[model samples]
Target: MRIEDKITTAFVLASGPFTDGSLWDAVSGRLGAAGAEVHAVTFSADPESHAGEVLRLIDSAAAPQVVLVGHDYGLHPLLAAARQRTGRVARIVHLDTAPPQDGDAPLALLPDPATQALLRDRPQALVPAPAPGEWARFGSTAGLTPEDLERLSALSEPCPGAVLTRPLRLTGALAAVPSSGILCTASGASIAGVQQLVSSGMPQFQALAEPSVGFFELATGHWPMLSCPEELTAALLLAAAGGGRRLTPAVTRPFHERPFVLDAAEAPRVRTGLVDLHLPAAEGPRPAVLLVHGGPLPRGLTPTPRDWPLYLGYARLLAGRGLVGAVLDHRLHGLSDYPTASEDLAEAVGLLRADPRVDPDRIALWFFSGAGLLLSPYLAAPAPWLRCVAATYPVLAPLPGWAGVDPAFDPAAALPMAGALPVVLTRAGLESPEIAATVAGFLDAADGCGAAVELVDAPHCRHGFDCSEPTEEARGAVRQAMEAVCAHLSGRVPIRD
Candidate 1:
């Protein structure tokens, strides 16, 4: 193997959406001046490509060593090329690109149930753009200048509906090289959507046993090359030098330190980890409630303090109800597996019930938003010891226009099972307009099943509100709801004034 300084030649993979190599002109030039040869490969305009195109680019690369960099959806193909010719590849970097999802759908437009229900019935109310000023809210954090944003807005290639919906298959290549994730928090795309993009890569990363991967969360949105070239370059150089891992600082003291394990998983799997319990309380048979974090994609199974606003408070509330609540971080959200998240929830609940300290009949289930859709199917299948369910602002249906490849769940399908179990469905009306109709529809079809529904008028509330600091109105509603649930489950009605 020939060495070119301490660095190898750089090969850029510009694959995804309606983009091409043209986007990397500025960044590539910078690398070229840094004594590295830069080669850019394009599968085709937009995301669709001929497999031969990527192979040709690899064959044309300079011999000895090369660093393969892929951005956005382009990472998939670049990964493929590297597999065919191993030695030719020195390192692979996924810049703001997600690996692959369960479905093949463009990130820009994938359907969720709420989006679908509204669009299908009232397409007229659908605005082409919502709050154009939303971009400005982030100010410079978006990573693009007014001019760059304009250029992208003008030349941006639209992703085909097919590419966005179809899930990429990378089970084979991911088994090969360990890949690093260069998540562009500063540019490229907003975190709201990019979180999912970053998460999609996790499956392959875990499969490769490459959990040692590094991440650079630059404070930028999509299009880092054009918007924040210098920061992006610095990140690239650091990554090439293998200095991209986020580690806890040495100056930290025990009192000043809260353990943030970069790799906290126990022996079984490096990716799996447990968050240390923070709040100290008397060890007793508290209600064992599991906290499942909700996001567009999984972040892993470890629950941080940040998740408290969405789940911990609710767990505390359950504990206040004479239940020892043990919150288990669902896989993929905080640090668990994508498919295994639901399974872990079941396992965690089982652990709670079997703990001799906890009453097996008191075990319950809770799912919110995205997690709701994921777990609802499991609830339908039946699990012993799951006494009741509380799903708030549930994502019961798929988005209409953004249906990604195969829809794993349909809210309509799970609606029927609600009748057979003791369930309490509540939604903060301000969060989702579709909730009223969804709950009403479910209640109408109860068919003598033991379930109840409540729609609360809580402003600026969405899913996970009860788990966080709720407004006075939301708090009141939540208190009432919890009381009602306990009363129903215990088969005793509280005296009403």
Candidate 2:
């Protein structure tokens, strides 16, 4: 990759995790030769103080206008500074790192969430920088050589565990700031890969498809400055000029807003802040199917999941089938909040069984997406009242990134304990790699333990097919899964047609 035009915008390089400014010496020289002024930052303090360091550098620059180029942990300080002075930044380039939200600490985004929590709780704990050879545990080291590793080891420092413990406050100041992403392919991620995640409506990557953002990819590992300095320089130059591949925002609506594929059957619904009940006009008690919506959704998300079309449609559809439908709300906003979510779910179920209108002897719990984690307890020790478990595109095991989440939340590991509890899972053919792996793992575990699992395949569909897919395959799969769940609720196994 080569840039025809020289770049005049000053580049403020923010180093990630273990490295410092000197790590960018080769890259800085290359940028300087191309007529750009460069300042590689050594983050001597916390994220906020590093922001001040960046601000001071910006203040001392001749043009007083700079492009903030940040890699991994370096992004926190760069983002902090950018939020402070959005007008002065030419562009913010995220170099192969997860872009942190307003309150996201490094621990939340990094691989080991459990270990990070342990370290955070200890008094004056610090995150020890890994020895050069051990860096692969943190990120891909596909392109670095022995010499490169030695150099990287020399240009690094131990991180203070306290950094970003306090949230980086955002005032929506960075919304208008144009941004770019530099993806490292050898790091197990690519520009195309990111687009796929954005298309899934994961919320976090939604901003990447906005008109103000662009993306570039390098066929190297995480540390592009060390592995491919010339190529990195070229991409940075183009990015500074607002030139890179721009993603067209996905046209599919999110699960909350999209109309459910099933036709809405009019049924009377009662709302209780915690659970929404859809009832059939029946005289006696009826079997109930609890519809659990999936999410790590923010508390502020309007028209909560229970009020969403998917949940409402499912509840009404069940009621029309001469059964009671219960839609529940659980608190599951962050990575570490699984315990809170579980407790909320348990309370909702207790309230559900105690209701006069619901037959306590016959009940089924249906889980979806991220709520898939909550399925563990019910499967691990199926209660006599629990009839069946139904899940759609569910995450059975923690994704690779969630290495430190509680192992007890794993449904795959709990399969052996799911004695005779009929299970139905709807799998998506086009699901993302991260999600597909978990679903596959769960099925494999169930097979190994001889657990009863009925699989329904939705071929050529994305993750949230029920909401986004307007095709026959998706609708058919949903119907099949529902039939299996209802059959089990009525004390019988569904016979395949």
Candidate 3:
């Protein structure tokens, strides 16, 4: 298909007072992440700023029904071109500017007398730095830290004067393409003004409210491209997605309030903690999965591929799929220290059960290897909120020299609880039948619980193999298990719609 026919490309036209197209660098990364093609253009002052080059670039760079994005002075001319190529323009996004007023002189028209006297003596303002710190002066710059600011400062360049001297006459363009304006607090006195102008009784164009073509104002200076790139990127993407809702950016903070402190009183003096939280979205409540990690916990282990970091990746995948998946370090390992870890798991389950964003009626427990033992007590007296349990290569039968560990560490004790809950068990090639037998014995004794067993042929498949080098079989196993859990929660057959 021709590029313009694709309808997925977005053209971000930039105005030149400053040739450095740094304004787009961060927002472009976000668009790329969200799977869109972006191109930046500069209409350097001269006749190029007036007309010809701008339309040509739009013709060459954009797809059919392009989302034409313009910043600063570029807004008016791009709108004019978009009007000319109405069929090719899907939406016109004006960042901190609006379409020109009727009777407003076009660039070809001499500088209007009203503005000429003022500009004749307009003192030259210093070229302001577009650094991160400079952007923080605006309220919209929240969530931006010094480092992000530093990155932007490095890419910024000086602005030119000629581009600023020109004013756009967009009356002709407004009659063609639909336009939406993203205005900043600094430049335009109010979004209401633009709305009023676009509303009724205006000399320019008819103010019929085009819901799709409107304005959104952020509490920031004239430059949102610099002050709040993340927010801007999010808003722009929403605009691109036909005005989708925005998600709050992830925050970095302590999982608990006590604050981290190390007490060298015990042999393994590392402090550990467990936390369960839900990320609420407007999409409605989603399934919540609880993660329990495997044996011989690594010292000070955070999420990395070497250990079962694959589960963390899986949780992210689940979250992306409109489900709420949580990962927690069990007691005696990870960030949670000793007795607290076990308490945390139970508390987390209880908490999720009470949460409105989580389907309190349908929580699934995902246990792998040694971590399977942590849920023994709960299995023994399974919570009303617990819907199903999946144990992959769980060490169900206590081996020799297993009694010295934590009481909650006894899967053998928890085995009886399996009778009341649905169970899924998986064994890989490297895992022996002895592992399966241990789990089977427990399930066999349970009155209502029969394990769904899946065994692989290879005798050497290591633990966490699915996570480390995922194959179709492994993915199938996880997907099947998830579907089973969802089915148990929903009280229906496990089938993907």
Candidate 4:
């Protein structure tokens, strides 16, 4: 790729934790060949100060402009230096990891929360470098060959404890620096995922959509220099020209703006702080259905699920058929919000049961999308008042980034405790392969349990088929599952189609 304007660049490479400038040997060689002045620096070994060496390198650079590249813990030092040298930095490139905020602790940004918690309790002054089995704990080592892993294990240094523990501090002005994020696709983040996060209105992820920012996906692992040095060098070249993928600033329309597959006349609804109650037409103490929407949904969506046709339509349909439809917002705002989300769901259930219009003894819980993990506990300890459980296109287990999540959320593991309880599951035949595997595992687990499992198939549909597909197959599947759930709540055998 031709450099725009052909301006000279001072390439400052900050290698990630546990390794020093040597980590950038291959990358620097390639960059130097391209006629760029490259200087790679090592982080401090001292526990109290980490990036002073990086600052010194930046201060001594003679080039007209600088492009800083950081990988893993290397980002910490690069970011720290960039804060002071904001004017000189032409563009900043983030490799694999998400960029940290002004006050974020690098340790907290580990691949998953569980690892973060474990490491916090056993803090080390100098964290050791990657070993064969230990590499995965830090990040994905997807493309590293056996020899590469050996070199990594042998050459990597110990990371200073202060680098991970200390909160990153910086002036807000750094946002103006043009930036590019190089996604190690094997590590689970991609440009498409970034767009989704941006659309969800998560302020932290929203920055990736800025006009000053762009992205590139490397079909490698967290350690790109070791896995594909040439490709990483190529990406860096393009990143210098601000030539990678730019995220669309526009918010993605929910479900491609698809209309609901099934709808019923709107019912009179009672709005509370956390929930909306759609009162059934049939009046007194009617059986109620509590719909639990799925996510890691960010807090700032303009037309949240409650306003979306999916939840609204489902609620009204339930109400028109003589069931009190209760749609509530839980606190599943981000990945770690699962614990709080469960609490909010429990409180919502209590609130629903306490309502005078709903039958306290007859209520069904329906889980959807990412909310499927919330189904475990109810499956584990079924209450007499909890009549039936239904899930649609559910995430039965932890998704990729959250694989280290608590096992208590495993629906398959909890099925044995369900005993004689009835379970209704509507599966999309065309569900994403990863999620489908989980649903399949849950079904396999159910086979040995006493729980009566009824699988409803939406053949030729997707994960959110109700909203995205809207075909007769989706409609029939939805209606079938709802009838089964409502029947169980009404203390009658559900007739299957």
Best by TM-score: 2
lDDT string, candidate 2, 70-158, tens digits: 88777888888888888888799998875666665655545544445656586246667667897775667778998888888777777
Arranged by TM-score with the best first, the candidates are: 2, 4, 1, 3
Q: Each prediction's Cα lDDT score?
A: 0.50, 0.80, 0.52, 0.78
Candidate 4 TM-score, true structure as reference:
0.78
The candidate with the higher lDDT, 1 or 2, is 2
> lDDT score, residue 173, model 4?
73
Tens-digit lDDT track for model 1 on 110-215? Answer: 2233433343355333222212233332122265666775655454454444443333444354445545666664433332333332322222223322344556
Q: Candidate 1: which stretches are off by over 4 Å?
A: 1-5, 45-50, 101-141, 186-212, 246-365, 368-370, 373-388, 391-486, 490-497
- State which candidate has the highest lDDT: 2
Off by over 4 Å in 2: 1-4, 46-48, 201-205, 283-286, 296-299, 331-340, 354-356, 359-361, 381-384, 398-409, 491-497
Candidate 3 TM-score to native: 0.38
TM-score of 2: 0.88
Tens digit of per-residue lDDT, candidate 4, span 1-497: 45623637878887666677887899889888887889887666663455677777777878777898987777877888788878888898888866765555667456545445655666555566657768777778898878877888787776655667777776677888999999988887777767755654333466678888979999888889889999998888888877888887635344524567886799999987688999876747878899998886645555666777788888998888888888988877655457678998999999999998988989899999889999989999999999889999999987655533445688999999998888999999987666888999999898876568999998798677787666788889988998888778764422222
Cα error of candidate 4 at position 274, Å = 2.2
Worst 10 residues of 3 by lDDT: 262-271
lDDT of 3 at 106: 26
Answer with 1 or 2, whichever has the higher TM-score. 2
lDDT, residue 140, model 4:
88
